[model samples]
Target: MSIFSGLQPPEAFAEAALALGPAPLVACHNDADGLSAGAILVKTLQRLGTEPSTRIVGKGENAYSDAFLDELRGRAMTGLVVTDLGVSSRLPDLGLPTVLIDHHVPTGVPTHACVVSGIEDDPIPTSSLLAYRCAKAIGVETGDLLWLAAIGLIGDMADEDGFPEMEEARALGITALRKAVSLVNAPRRTASGDASAALGLLLKADGAKAVLSGAHAETAALLQAKEEVKAALDAARKIGPKVSAEVALIPFSSPCQIHPLVAQAWRTRIRDRIVIAANFGYREGWVHFAARTGEDRDLIAFLAEHRPPGAGEEYGNGHRLASGGALRLADWNHFVHAIGFGPELEAAA
Candidate 1:
């Protein structure tokens, strides 16, 4: 049976939740897909007359932890619904019914939970789309909010042609959808409120049109952050490009907090090479690495197979074509050498 077979459609999921009596504690990732997924589930639960508690965890390493379990134990929620996350973390026993809705490749599906992910037979879909399926199944009026799923699809850079639902979302117009995606992602690392604020705006406003019209002012941080990213991109560009036989590296330090946008910008400019943007996180005493490769190469697999022995101190994760993580300063030379690249860094010693 498909792992997703155990997960019910939206209406059935809602019915099962209703049967459970107590509301769920919804944990979402702090990204466009995750934020939108959480909002969709939370709003649907509210519509079902259950007020669910919610929490946000950082991208990869911080998604599941002892503190997270303790937070859940302290809550009144009787169930757990994790969206756009949990695939990377070992799902621990919370002694409650747990459902994980995620899109990333799972390390291993925990036997203790019902997992909705892109694994084996299941085609990868954004978590927001999965949440919308549930909301639609529940007979909730979702016509207005359907565009929210499209925003996440674009944010994740997923191809929209295959899914008719995504096609319908794309029909809303490209300008609006792209703007909405930028609004969500631009502030994700530098500021906290932009993505949430955009989600709220999309959910409450009159669909995509309203979101497109007002996203600029509401996410003004996006504009400022873009400028900062542009400067970082310039610095990365000036570093020219260093190459090994297998890959290219563009290492630089930014005065502003390193957002995914800056890395993405650098990736677009240097598409000819397998680009690794290593942002120096001076304050944290580590270097955060964002790697982008072509369709033929698997960034995650490469990172796994060539990971530095000293990577024990690093933290982060990402998808196949693109991924990001952090490593301690001490691991710099080992990390470069591990990837079959000669080290060109000043010795930390």
Candidate 2:
């Protein structure tokens, strides 16, 4: 069972992959999953005799923005392939054919684009796995890259083990988790190139050892980030547990901006309760929130039900268990009270 077992790529995708002789522009996100998806697509394109030109979205930016559109317009491309990103509310018509392979909740549907997303019925699979299956469907032999999909799955924290679609990806040992972490943190460790060098490494590396060994700085950064998160979680654990409450809140303030990863780690430690961790940067007059909750306390649904002041629906988006968004400094107290957090608790201990 492949993650893409029954799902089919859009007709435009197959036409562009097979008939369009010119190389395609593959724009992807900078995260580990996005890089993995980008690498898989790059390999598939090369095997089909067309080398793809890869572009990465910057941190804290959406995939479809004015700058990105301007860059796309400058390229002499025949077709476009977007993976692990396409949640933009405003997608400009690029005139050229496009393929969107992603699992994120779409903000708006693009015209003249073939979207391959897992929004309605099927279990969400990482864009990397989806792209690999799409490549295979188009007659590219991608047998060796099944393990790569596992890396994306781990990086995205998308554990679809029980789902029928992820049978093959789940079969691959979870060793890629460490490698995924390295790939994710590499860009954060360096000021320049962000995920550019790391994406190149992933695309060219022979195996997990090659990637992990090459990402020394990234691994160290990840370790430090984890330690910081552990410290925060440990302090939160000392706070009295609320057995009657549906959610547990951990508000923190740190110089480092790693709320999403910290929120995930905190969720793992307190799986029995819904976890909401807010990282406040008072200087910026905003607080970024990362929440983890089960189906009973679906984070996405809660975000949808409660719109933060001065923010749109697009501001809060992600999976069922994990979601994130930001709020203004003025709204912080209101948001906290809305989520049932008391005012007396100290944000940082």
Candidate 3:
């Protein structure tokens, strides 16, 4: 049976909804996967006869900050749904009925009433898929949301071989969705600039149709941006592999619109190798890394084990063999060295 099959909206989820009995508030991560997951949850809740206000808390590592939690608390939310985030730390203090749907390995399960994450049993299913299942358990169906779900899977790097069901689902009709997500996710001239644009679209988009249309339009822009970034990455790849040393630092920048694509391209080229890529943004910074091929190099485990003291698990993902993180420029060297890439790069430097 599919891993997703076992996922049922826990009784606590419905009870929590019933307890709220009216408009609830939702907080979700602010990326393609998180936004997609949030959309699914929101639509599902609406279908179940509840209208909820939704907010994007930000992206990656900052998604689950104490400030975000305080903001939600200030809203007097009766019930809270957190998607694509691991809020184990804040759960104890949240003091409200909550449901958490996430895909990353848990730092610890929330003591809250309902916590559903892929890490519990199935490592293969994406959080979107899990959220879809949870939605179904609560009598909320979103067949139209499949495309967003697929995007979340890809964005979360949950495309491993075991997820044949997800692959098959993606094959059904996800080209447009992928393009849409790619567009919003494409790198930009500035980190905050494109992110701001993407967040605006997410906030304004009404339903699946709107999301699909808006994403498609944005994707066209993304493709154009991708072309430019791809050219830069291609050049970097050509020069990058020849740097016969322990660490190969590929520092290059493109319009922020194509950053994700550039990161994806780098992942492909540096398979099983330790590589770091950074894009300088006008107001913010973006960094990505991959450990493609190596001997017993479990990049995901490495990051999970050594993530910075205060950094949340929201910004990182990988299996034992591969892992990646989004970091601010200030902590760039710290993370780079944490992954043991610094010593390796000393020779190259």
Candidate 4:
């Protein structure tokens, strides 16, 4: 049965996955949870006797973009599985069979694909968890994949949600799992933004210890990437926030993707206001920001109200409490000015 967080029926999504031919493309986001989900999907498809091709959608890349479509067209593929990346409301229909597995708050429903979303579930399951369930529903060897679900759980900060799967996986070893998550997440957050090392580890490792055992070359790469991001974060953390009304904006520039970590670090101290950590150096010509709030307010709605004209579908698309987006320098200027920050706060053109 297709339990995919208990929202979809058994026939809803599994049928679509089963319909796909041998050469299906699995496109997933570049993160610990996303990579874990991709690995799970790979194992599932392999069990079904198909050799699937996996692609990592790095930061700033969209799976549904025209460029992505063009790339997909160039490949000889019969099916597609998109995971972790948020979907466009007006999702385009891929001609071949498709299955979308995700847990983010979707903007709209896709009419053409089997969407296995966990948005409705209380304490929503992460993408890897959903993939695990889907694998189980289709009658695969999920017993060995439990630790993967645990890695995604710890990575997404949902380890405290108390899922039985987590408890079971924890028995295998939680420290290694958490460390594996940090290592697996490191490569994607570095300046290179290549998560192949992390994904490769997930694809081959039998368990959490196997990932951190230093037995594979991928493990060394992951460790190096973690140290790189750590240095960048140390420099960015020294800068404090500039508060305005209920918003506490901490603006800094870093090549590493540490804005989310910065926002989270300051989130507790600025418990009364929304914490926004904006980074100008993560990507050229754009400002990347992460919003976190201790206040029980709808950050998505908050962003919608203050969203600058230039902000596209990329903005305000994550969870209600923690959401962020990238904006061009010009649009970012408008956003900061509108939010009552001065010109000095705007991204330099």
Candidate 5:
């Protein structure tokens, strides 16, 4: 009757875990997907009589940077598990036994270790699903984590296609999480700094009821923030239709705090098959880019190839059409040019 009852882990993953001794190091994404994956890993390790040191990193942050590599060296970590992130070519350089369990489009598979992902060839899977399989491989059979895993799936927009099994597992629980996600995703103005507070509430909430009740304060705050998001969206719309033929650009100078919501608003107005909305962030030197693909195109693939150096895919749970990234303010013009938009479009927006 457990959600994971019929699930089986890969043979290679079991072999790798067996080869490595106790006390593994887990590097996971900071978002819902990564958090759920990390939680599953923790439970699995505990069941296996092993301990794991957990570290959370933002998706947009450089996972392979020298600082991260140096941290790994300092830990003297022998076994590494990366979840909910795309595999980079630099992964092998860390000089540790590694296992990759992710759901992103891979740049390339690692030659030095076991890699598991959900690329085009494989049936679509979430990082939490991969983590659950890994847990099963190690003989851990807890089903309590399904709700958490479902949160990642919904947060990443994976629910669009509708995973019947996951949906059945989530049942009424997902409704509360969706409300929580919406409240947390509200826009920001000034430096009220409610975004982090919202995320904290979602992360710590005990259950569906707790999550909903905990978000009340944030929801109130979001009611006020919604105005700013609307204003930015309105501004973007004023600029979009005129610039459609010349260049597709949605520009707003507002210090919008909720990047995703603002982008979604702009996208709603765009009738084009492909629309990209650019917005000014709280920081003066940066801009956020949200690209929404028409039904005809795959925005996930497009954003993956076009993302800036520091950018990472938002995953939109599974709404491949909705994706976002950030770019330096200085590179804004160059990015627009690279995307094939012209100066006239810039002028119009």
Candidate 6:
């Protein structure tokens, strides 16, 4: 029999999740969607058999990063399940059965791994919903977990995708789910970029109400994170953008991950140009930026044309219209120059 009972990539992925046995390490991204997905798998794994260990890939770290893979080495894991992290052939060979569950456009899919991608879906399913399907295929009663997937849908702004489950969840309480998502997203946006508290709340909370009830200590942490991020965002929003004919570059330095929000804030206002929000202070020795365009331009191809030498997988790796990346100071300077910006925004070497 096939490991996933002869199903295809995605359906097989759900089945593989159920079969990946003894002890698998579930590595997930550190955003609201990622954490919710991880939480679902963690819950499902617990109900199935032995509990699975989980690693939340946070700021400046990816599942295949050397530091991350080093942490996985020598662990007594029998399998690996990765969610929400972007797919790439750079996936390290850890000599174990692996499954990748994601919605990001794949640059390359590892041949040895089972990839469940909803990237081509008209309305892409978030990793949380994908993990929920895994839970169902495991034959566990997942009525409670449906709301968990709803939390991710709202977090990723897919609440309007019109999935029946989303409507059912909305009837449960959209306001609460929205609030919980913001809270969950806040911790990882802060300078510390630690999402442990957010993950902790998701892992144990019975539902959205439990997440926001102020009943758990982690809830307080999330609230504080929200306040910190809001202040940072307000400060970033105050700065004006340097507009060119075709692109608007809004450059600000902050410890918060506010570049995406800043770019989003400008995409509507500028309407005629691609809005690039660059945050040079989010991490040391790197410039992180997000690109948003009002038009239907293919940003990934646009970025590839002006690609910087130092740009890695972090560059132009998201959806075609909505993508961004990190570049070293030198490469960022090269990028700004290549895009027709003068020396004013270039970093001092």
Clashing pairs in 6: none
The 10 consecutive residues of candidate 4 with the worst lDDT sum are: 1-10
RMSD of each: 3.7, 5.2, 5.5, 2.6, 6.5, 3.1
Pick by lDDT: 4 or 6, better one: 4
Output the better candidate (4/6) by TM-score.
4
**lDDT minimum window of 10 residues, candidate 3:** 2-11
In terms of TM-score, the best-performing candidate is 4
Score each candidate by Cα lDDT. 0.65, 0.64, 0.56, 0.86, 0.59, 0.86
Clashing pairs in 4: 2-10
lDDT of 6 by residue, 1-349 (tens): 3222211344575567766788989898889899999999888888888669988888888676677778888678989989999888888888888888888878777887888877766688898988887777768778889888998898888889977778888877888898899899998899899999999999889999999999999999999999999999999999999977678999999989989989999999988888999998998898999999999898988899999988888888888778899898999999998887998888665
- Candidates ranked by TM-score, best first? 4, 6, 1, 2, 5, 3
The per-prediction tally of clashing pairs is: 1, 0, 14, 1, 8, 0
Tens-place lDDT per residue, model 4, 1-349, is 3323233532355677788899998999999899999999999999999999999999777776787777887888889898898755455566889788989887776767778887877779899998888888888788988998898989999999988888888889889888899899999899989998898999899998999999888999988999999999999989989998878999998888899999999998989999999999889999999999999989999999989987877788899889998899999999988878888898879
Better of 1 and 6 by lDDT: 6
Whole-model alpha-carbon lDDT for candidate 4 = 0.86
Per-residue alpha-carbon lDDT of candidate 2 for residues 159-246, written as tens digits (9 for 90 to 100)? 5545433466555445655555455645632323256666776776655665666444444444454455456445544444332256
Instruction: Please give each candidate's TM-score.
Output: 0.82, 0.76, 0.71, 0.96, 0.72, 0.95
Best-to-worst lDDT order: 4, 6, 1, 2, 5, 3
lDDT of candidate model 6 versus the reference: 0.86
Q: 1 or 6: which has the higher TM-score?
A: 6
Query: Candidate 2: misplaced stretches above 4 Å?
Result: 1-12, 16-23, 70-76, 86-89, 158-193, 213-247, 255-257, 268-273, 282-285, 328-334, 340-349
Per-residue lDDT over 276-341 for candidate 5, one digit per residue giving the tens place of the 0 to 100 score: 666564455666656665456677666555544544332222346666566665455555665666
Tens digits of per-residue lDDT for model 1 on 168-241?
Answer: 87677878778767666654454232345545554565655665565446545455655655565555556655
Candidate 3 local lDDT, residue 221? 51
Task: Give one digit per residue, the lDDT tens place, for model 3 in 29-99.
Answer: 66667777777777778877778888766433344566666666678556788776653544635566777
